[model samples]
Target: MHLIHRPDIVASEITPPDVYLDRRRFIGQAAAGAAVLAAGGLLDPRAARAATAPREKLIGVKKSAWTVPEALTPYQDVTTYNNYYEFGTDKADPSENAHTLKTRPWTVRIEGECAKPATFAIEDILKIAPLEERVYRMRCVEAWSMVIPWVGYPLSELLKKVEPTGSAKFVEFSTLADPQTMPGVRGRVLQWPYVEGLRIDEAMHPLTLLTLGVYGEVLPNQNGAPVRLVVPWKYGFKSAKSIVRIRLVDKMPVSAWNRAQPSEYGFFSNVNPEVDHPRWSQAKERRIGEFRKRDTLMFNGYADQVASLYSGMDLRKWF
Candidate 1:
C-alpha cells in the first residue's frame, strides 16, 4: 500500500483513517473513492481542490525510497494562501498583489567558506543543475500542513561546491531585497529583508532541498521564482523564499522570525506537536480546503526517520 499526501484536504478536520499504507495505494484508492462520491453527488472537497491542482515532479539526485504520488493542491491554493510575507500581511492577499512584479536577472550571492565565494546568475545556476521530483510532507508553524511535489536537488550538493570551513557552524540565507520586484519589501512588517538560518548539520540533512521549480513548470514569479530552500522539518517560514544570498558563518545567525519573537520561532524549528506555539496549539492542524481537522503527528509524521536527531535535547524549548 502506498501513502499519497493530499494537501487540499483539511486533514485535522477529518476523522483519523482506520488504516495507513504506502503512497501508491493511498492515492489510487483515494482518487477512486472520490470519483465514486462525485458520481453520487457527494464530492470530497479535497478532490475538488485536487481537480484544479497542478501536477509537479518531486525530484531527487536518485530515486528516493520515500517517493509519493504526484497529487498536488492548486498553485494559487498553495502560494496565494501562504503566510510567508516578510513585510506585508502574512495571508493569501500578498501573493495576488505579487503577480504584478517581475522576477529575472536575479543573482544569488554565495559567501563564507570555500576557495571561491561568488554570486551566480540565476540562469547559470539553472543551467548547471537538472531538476528532479520528490514528494514531501510540508508542515507549517501555523499548525496546518500540506504535501508538496518539489522539483530540485539536495542543498548539500550545491553546498559542496562552496566548501565550508572547519569553523563554519551555520548557514544564513537572505531573500531578495528589491521592493520593486517584491512589494512586501516596502513595509517594516518583518526586518525588510527576510532572513533564515540553519545549522551545518541541518543544512546537510537529506531532506533539505534547493528548489528551482514545481508543478511541472517554471516557478511562478510570485512563488519565489528563481530559487529557494525547502526544509521539510522546519516551519515554512524558515524556508526563506526568493533567496538571494547565502553566507556561511561560525556562529548562529539571527533569523527573521526568531528576531521578531524568539518565543515563537526558534533556531531549530522542527515540528513537534507537543511544543505548542504561543498563539496556537501544535497538537493538531487544520489541513487546507478540507473542513475536517486531523491530529498532528510527531515531527509532522516523519518522526520515525528524524526523531533520533533530537534524542536528548529539549524540543519543547527549541521549538
Candidate 2:
C-alpha cells in the first residue's frame, strides 16, 4: 500500500507521547491480570516500562513512498514486545535486559566479495544517505504483526559503497553477541554472532532498509540499536538486529534460524500465509494493540512489490 501525502500534517503532529503512554500503561496494567485474555497473551506488564526509556528526536526524516496507511502500533508496544533472542526468549526480556547493551564505539565490518571492503563507524553509516521514515507492516512467524515507523535509507546505499564483485550473489548480516552484556548469549541458543542473509537482489531492493531508528528517535537497545536490517516483505526474523558485520558472498549463507531448524525456517523466509510453521498456522495474525485477528497476506501485503523475485520458484518448497 502506498502512503498518501498530507502536506498539512507533519511528524511532530502525530499522536502525542503522553496520550499513548497513558493508554499503554492502562492496557499493560489490565494485561497483567488478564494476560491470557489479551491478544493471546502478547501483552505484558513490562511494556509499560518502555514509556520511561529515553529517546532522542530524529531530524530530517523524510516520508517515503513505501509507507502504508495503517495506524502505527504504539511506541511502547513496538519497543517492549520484541523477539531479540540475544537478550532473552521472552517478549518482555529484551526491554527489561537490553539496557546493558552499549551502542557507542560501534563499527560494522564490510568484507568478503566486495572490492572496497572497509569498516564503517556508526556515525559514518548514518551519514551514508538521508534518512526516510517508512511505515511498514512487520509480520512475525508467531502469527503477530505491527506497523512500525522505521527511519533509515535503503540498504543498497551502503552496499554500493563497498562495491561488491560480480560473484557476490548473497549478503550475510551478523549481530553482536556479547555474553557480558547480552546475558542470553551465555547460553546455547542458536549460535554466537547471530547470522542472517539475503539474495543480492533482495539486499539491493528498495524496500530493504538498513534501519537506524524508529518513531523519529534513535533505536532503543531492545529494538536493535546502532544498526539493523528491515525486510518488510519477509517475516520479522529476517530483519536481523544489532548488526555488526555485513558480508558479500557467492553462495547462500546459512542463517541462524535456518541452521537451528532447517525444516521450519527456510533460507528465503518470505511471509507466506500458505506455508505454516511446524507448530502454528500462518494464515492469520494478530496485529499489536488490536483484539481481532487479520488474514495474513502474501509477502505480508507487499506481494505487489516483491512477488516477482520468486516468480518461478516454489515458495512452499523454498520456505
Candidate 3:
C-alpha cells in the first residue's frame, strides 16, 4: 500500500498573511516532497500538529489564523476524493457533479420536543445564526481523512429557536433522499434516508456545527448541498449530509450505521486510537494526499476540550 506523508507545518513557522505563497507553486513543492518522503519511508507520523492546538487556528476566520489539523491537511493533496455523494458516488466525482444539485426551496423540518413544530426555509437559518469558517479534521471509518475548511454556525444557536423540551435527550439528523437527484440512494449500500443521532450535550457542544458551505462557497451538492452536520471528533459517517430534518427526541434514535451494523457503529463514535474497530485497527489513518499516513489522535485531537463532557461514562463500552 502507498503510504502518504503527514503535512509538515510547524505552528510557529506558519506563513504570515503579508507573504502570499502562490497556491499553484506551493502545491508543486508539497507534491514532490510527499513523493520523496513516501519512497524513502522517512515520514514522521508523530509530526502532526499538537493535539491541543490553539483555538484560533481551528476556528479562525482567515487562512492566516488557520493551521489545519494534521489529520485533515492532506485532503488538499487529493482533490478528487471525498465521502459526500449527493453530488455523485465516485470518490473523485462529487466536486464536479455536485453543481447540478439545486439548493433553493430547501427547508429544515423541526419536530418532536418543541412546543411549536416548525418548518423554516434555508434562508431563514442563516438569519438565525451567522456562518463562521472552521477548519477541522474529518476522519472516516474507512481509515481515510480530510482537512476541511467549513462554513457553518453552531447547532446550538439554531436548536435554541426550536426550544427542545427538558425531555429532549438526543437530536436526530436525517438526510435528503431523492432518487431523482441523488442516484446513489438507488443503490443498496445503506438503508434509504440516511440518519444520524447525537446526545443533547454532544449536539450542543461548542465544536459541533450545522454546516451549509465550505471553502468560502455555498455547499456543492456532493458535499451535502443545502446543509450538513460537522462533528470533528467523531468518524465522518456520524456527520449526516444533506440534512432535511432535526428532531429533538427523548431516546437514542436509531442511526443508519448503528442500524446497519449494531456492534460496529456506536452512538458515541469519537476517535480513540487505543480502541480498535472490530474489523480494523484505527491507530493510524491515511490523509488524502501523495501517500501520507499519520497517527490518529484521540478525539481526533479535540480530547482536551471535549473529554470532560463524557467524564464518568465508559467510552470503551460506549463503542
Candidate 4:
C-alpha cells in the first residue's frame, strides 16, 4: 500500500488538541466583550461604531458538510487583520476605517443576461435562503491564511431565483465604492466600484458562498458587511466584498486586480502551489495565529471538489 503524500501538514504546524477544543470558549468571550460594547457609551470610534452597527446572531444557522476539521483562527485575528483596500491599504485599515460603512438600507442590483433582473434589498436577499455555517480555509494572495466560520447560502440559491439566460456565460460582481463613506476610495489605490468575475459554472458551484455573516453573527463592517462572495478555491482578493451589483454576461469581465496589474493578478486566481505570485512564493503560507508555515494546497485543498472546473486548461497560461 502506498502512503498519500501530505505536504500541507507539518508537525510544528499541528494545532494542540486542547487549543482546538477551547476555540468555542474564546469565541464566546469575544462575543461577550462585543455585547458590552454594543450596550453603548464607548469613547473609541471603533467601539462607538460597533455600538451603532451591532451584529445580531444569525438564527437557524445550520452546520454545513463543507466545513474543514481544522482549528479556527481567533475571532479577533480574523476581523482585525484584513485586506479591504476600499478602506485602506494596511492590514489594520479596514477594521479602523470600515466602521463608517452603512450596511442597512442597502440593495444589490442583479442585471444582464437574466430573465428576472431586479434590485433586491439586503433583508430580502437574506430571506431568499436559509443560512448555513461553513468553516472554510481562506487563503490570501498575500501569503497568509485563516480558517473562518462563514454563515451564508450557496450562491446558486440566489442565482436560480433570477434565472440566467442561455447567453449568460460569466458572472460579474461589483463592490460599493462611495468616496465619502469609504475614505480610501478618495485615493487612487484601485479603480472605484471594485469588480470581480467567475465563469458561469463556477458561480453556480455549491462551494461559491454568498456570505452574510461570520463567527455566528452578522458580518462586521470590516469583514464585508451586507453581503459578499466567498470562493474557497481562489485567493481572498477574488472574493469581492460589500457587493452592490451582480451581472451575468457572455463575455469575460475584467476583474479589478487583473485590470490593475495584469502581470501579477489573474482573473482565475486559483491557489496553486506550482504557480507562484510574481513577488512571492505561493508554495507555503502562514496561518494568522500560527508561528510555523504549512505548504499551500492545490485549489486551497479543495482540489477534489473544484479541479474539474479547470480540466484540460493550462493553468499557467490562464494564470
Which number leads on lDDT?
2
**How many steric overlaps does candidate 2 have?**
0
* Residue ranges of candidate 2 with Cα displaced over 4 Å: 1-44, 47-51
Better of 2 and 3 by TM-score: 2
Rank the candidate models, highest lDDT first.
2, 4, 3, 1
- Candidate 3, residues 43-122: lDDT per residue as tens digits? 53222211221122222333423336444453233234666654455665555455455678899999998877799899
Q: Judging by TM-score against the true structure, name the best candidate.
A: 2
What RMSD value applies to candidate 1?
Answer: 12.5
Expressed as tens digits, the lDDT of each residue in 1-319 for candidate 1 is: 6498667768554534643445667788778877868676345433332322223443334444556453566665766666657425756444555665455778888898655688888777765556677777777787777777777778887777777778778999998767775666777777868899998888887778888876656665556666989887677778888888999888899999889899788888888778888888888887776578778778767777677777899887767
* Candidate 1 CA-lDDT value: 0.73
Runs in model 3 deviating more than 4 A are 1-79, 85-89, 96-100, 290-292
Lowest summed lDDT window (length 10), candidate 4: 43-52
When superposed on Cα atoms, how far off is each prediction in RMSD?
12.5, 10.2, 12.2, 14.1
Candidate 2 per-residue lDDT, tens place, 77-109, comes to 898889999999998889989999999999999
Using lDDT as the yardstick, the better of models 2 and 3 is 2
